[model samples]
Target: MTAVQLPELPDLPGKRFPRRVPVRQILCLVPLLLVTVVAVRHRSVLAEGFGQLRTAEWPWLLVAVGATCLTWVAAAFTRQGAVVERLPRRRLLATQFAAGAANHLLPTGLGASAVNLRFMTVCGVPLARSSAALALYLLAEAVGRLGLLAALLVAFPDALRLGTLLPHGAVGPLFAAVGAVLVVAAGVLVFVRRLRTAVCSFLRTALGEARSVHARPARALALWGGSLAFPALQATGLAAVGLALGLPVPPVHMALAYLAATVAVALVPTPGGIGSVEAALIIALVAAGGPAAVATAVVLAYRIITVWLPLLPGALTLGALLRLKVI
Candidate 1:
């Protein structure tokens, strides 16, 4: 050891390792990156949407824009209605807007659900209660949509020609498929003891929350009213776009087509129902007696206003919220 004495290392007690990365700062950049990627991926769509806007009737387009804005308000209201505790109003609205952008990034509404769940948890709601509220919101929304569809179908018998969109033989198979899925799900729930127990616990919590929410008249009204208004506004935005583009379809028929198309593709695992939604809308519009070209134009313009135009700003808001630790 004396023959080959090793050099002593410098005494650096606190500087032995590199500093940790700023994870929060890195997280803040993620939303911007996602926005850029999405915008680039759909550049053609963005261009076409803008072109459609140029040729559209501004008055109706403005109406569509207004309807689109109201949707966020409606979503906020519905979210509030799902829980007994009051959430920060401004942050709730901002969350809904950010959730819209998130929804387009993930398939089957997972992005939106995740954002809202996180937000609720941050607002001091328990995870189980937050989940139950989410389920309640979904159930209310679905009921509102289907109820509106049925009412519209009854009011205007010829609004949607289902025969054209779905072959007579297809209906049976579709129902059977849905039934089979339900049965399989039920069987799994029954066979899995742990899962069944967890589900039962969740159900009890959900029922209790539902009762608490309903006990308050204002909360109940907001929940059901907002749920109904959200889909109505969505359909209205689509109808307004159809009018702006001079599609040869009545406004009522256009609304009917939108509701039908959306419901048909509700289970489709597409990000924001992008391709499937467009195709379904066009087909439904055609079935509703609109020209295919005009229907396509309307769908493009509608998507632009509702999804594309606000996407960047929404993503920016999401990043800001993350930096602030609001969700």
Candidate 2:
């Protein structure tokens, strides 16, 4: 005969209640909270921004929209450059659009990186190689953006004077914090042999992949050219918005301001750099000699055209791609 088991009794003298929290619920509400806070804090600015948008030049806004669209094409070209295998042209562009939606849902490009990684694997690229390609694409894009920024600085020395832009007191603390983090990271890598080995292997693969990609002139051109175009288009969109809002800053200065603001906020892990980017862009534009109210309006208009307007369609496309299993 089988015996039935009885439930165990609690050992505590009093009742023991579970204190578990809903972590997923908390996470879901965080972004909403941040958005609410930002909205309340900048309510007046947003009101003026909306007013400016209503009265803004339609032609310049249209140009900003066009530039925003071109960024997708640039992303597609950069993705094509990343791998030796040819990806379907239409699908590649669709993926970039979908990836943009994903990008705003997660921090520091994680969402886009995940989507692209999956796409590469679906296209029959090995995981290791795909990762290498991703690394190469990011490195190329960063270098291209910095190069563009440097060239602009050279061309317009007085446009965005860094000395006034960066706060005096923050520099030392920023460098110190960065140095401490690097030192700790280095210590961990030195102590953990397994992690060290894995990292070394990945680096080797990435270097080899980079070498092969550079050997092909077309691939090299596509990678660097697309990288350069992506940021240039982004800056153009900002500049167009500035024009639309009649910001006093010159077009070149606006472009430089865009580059400086974005580059500074790149390391921020906030989703789509929403809060941080808005703040940085406003500061940069103000430094570029645009009036505060006008700069706020330009940033809002640019974000609306580039981000909010496209978000829903991009999400729908993302769902379609997932259902079709093209990603």
Candidate 3:
């Protein structure tokens, strides 16, 4: 009888065991799965959203589209203000557009930040200066947003019924989360000597840059004005959608709702605040007295114009920029 030969096992270059599954990839997918489930559960609202789109007023929708376009311009101007070195105008604008697309791929604002940081360095800014400029930009943006929110809340005293925005008992969890973050941050600063030194150096550089930018009136105006306008334009876009869909909320109230929702979801680390933003916007709109179905429709339409519509063109632009070595 011929000796039987077992087929050779598939090659394993170095290990004796098969490759392990990617736990990190699977963990990242969990949030996406949760978003899908939420979407499925609210399929009815989304269907209503489609119906609302069919009957949406063309002129108001057009205005919303324009506002969305202006957001990129606002971002570009703000970016220019962040650094003293002059950036190429057309390339800067293109980078802002591409940054918007990149934003949805990573948690919080990291993807956009990374893209802009790279663009600055490629434009001949030193790495230390670019990092400092990024920090300054973020600082200005946060301050502008908070200032706007305060102004809106004050001017439209009854615009939002706060209780509706935060359901009973949510305040406790929110406080707890904030406390945990503070504790962790303190621990890091205390224990991580290298990280602490780096952070201190970065902060000193950022402060110097901020002072220099503010000393120039035009740069100061561009930095603060564009930062303020960016959020206002975003809120206006939402208001335009509300108008297009015939939501009952007044423009001022709608703006208030937009500001509140965005601020509430700002700390959420999900990519572009995906699930948190939608939920917060819907809740805020309802609190502002729009019907739930109509509010849902408005959020869906707003996101389409601002986030999804520009995504493809922005992505193509990113690829072209990469090929040209512009970023």
Candidate 4:
């Protein structure tokens, strides 16, 4: 609403940044429409799935929503905690919700992220400090995701099962899931430390180049970790959506999908990773061995629960934050 809090951000080396575009609600909604079309063409599947929803085990749905909400709330708390002087939980939560909306509506994933950093500045957080804090929050998120991936790999052998529908096609995804988890694990083991260093160094570089964006290395790491916890909590929400839809999908697969989808979309640079996330979700679900129809249903439902459901709250929060002069 207010002039976006974008001061020229410092440029960093080896950072593959996307060009920022004006936020376009229509562009963001297009993917939702595409998803609708894909979902509609599978009408019988929808009817079957929705019908199953009616008879669905209410316990699972309740638990799923609970977990989903908790995850984001945790995320809010995590970010709130990381600040030198804390932002109100309500404020953080509102920003997070608004960011989620922005992520969906803005194509480049940066829309919400960029907005938040600017908001932080508006809240009187210096650009360098706010930027570092959010970076740390993001780092934590990656760690949490990969940690879940490792747990799933070790704890659930067939974490990616494709219901009882297929003979053994599901096996491929099991391996794929394992492979994906292992890939992330290996990266963590080998590169995470270095990656942290790189991020810090990159921030320094960006600041040196752009002047406005800056963050201390240690603070950045801390904030990044804090930001990450919320993402880990999301597995419960995804699993819940599956349960609600009568998709016998595991929470682990949701974790895997979330990790894959989130990471993939971050790289995509589209606001909220719109097309990237939905498509990645479908692929991730399939990799987890969910039936095509079931994957479609669950992914759509998960997006609805996770993405759309929270938009209004976020928008309201964004407005409030602006009104209160908090960015």
Index of the highest-lDDT prediction = 1
Across 56-174, the per-residue lDDT of candidate 3 in tens digits comes to 89899999899989989999889999999889999999999988877865687997998899999999999999999998899889999899999999988998889988879999998
Candidate 4: list runs displaced more than 4 Å: 1-57, 157-228
> In candidate 1, which residue pairs clash?
none
lDDT of 4 at 277: 74
Report the Cα lDDT for candidate 3. 0.86
Best by TM-score: 1
Q: Model 2: how far is 284 from its true place, Å? A: 0.3
- The estimated TM-scores of all candidates read 0.94, 0.85, 0.84, 0.62
Of the two candidates 1 and 3, the one with more favorable TM-score, higher being better, is 1
Q: What's each prediction's clash count?
A: 0, 0, 0, 25
Can you tell me which runs of candidate 1 are displaced by over 4 Å? 1-14
Q: Give lDDT tens digits, candidate 2, residues 1-327.
A: 999999998786887799898664454444445445545665775575567779899999999999999999999999889888888899989999988877876786897898899899999999999999999889988998999999999999999758767888989999999999999999999999999999999999999998888889898888999999999999999999999889999999999999999999999998788778889999999999988888888998888777666766776777677767787
Could you give candidate 4's per-residue lDDT for residues 240-312 as a string of tens digits? 7776666655666667666666654565666455456777777777777677788777776666556555655
Residue pairs in clash, model 2: none
**Model 3 CA lDDT for position 155:** 89
lDDT against the true structure, per candidate, is 0.93, 0.86, 0.86, 0.62
Off by over 4 Å in 3: 1-51
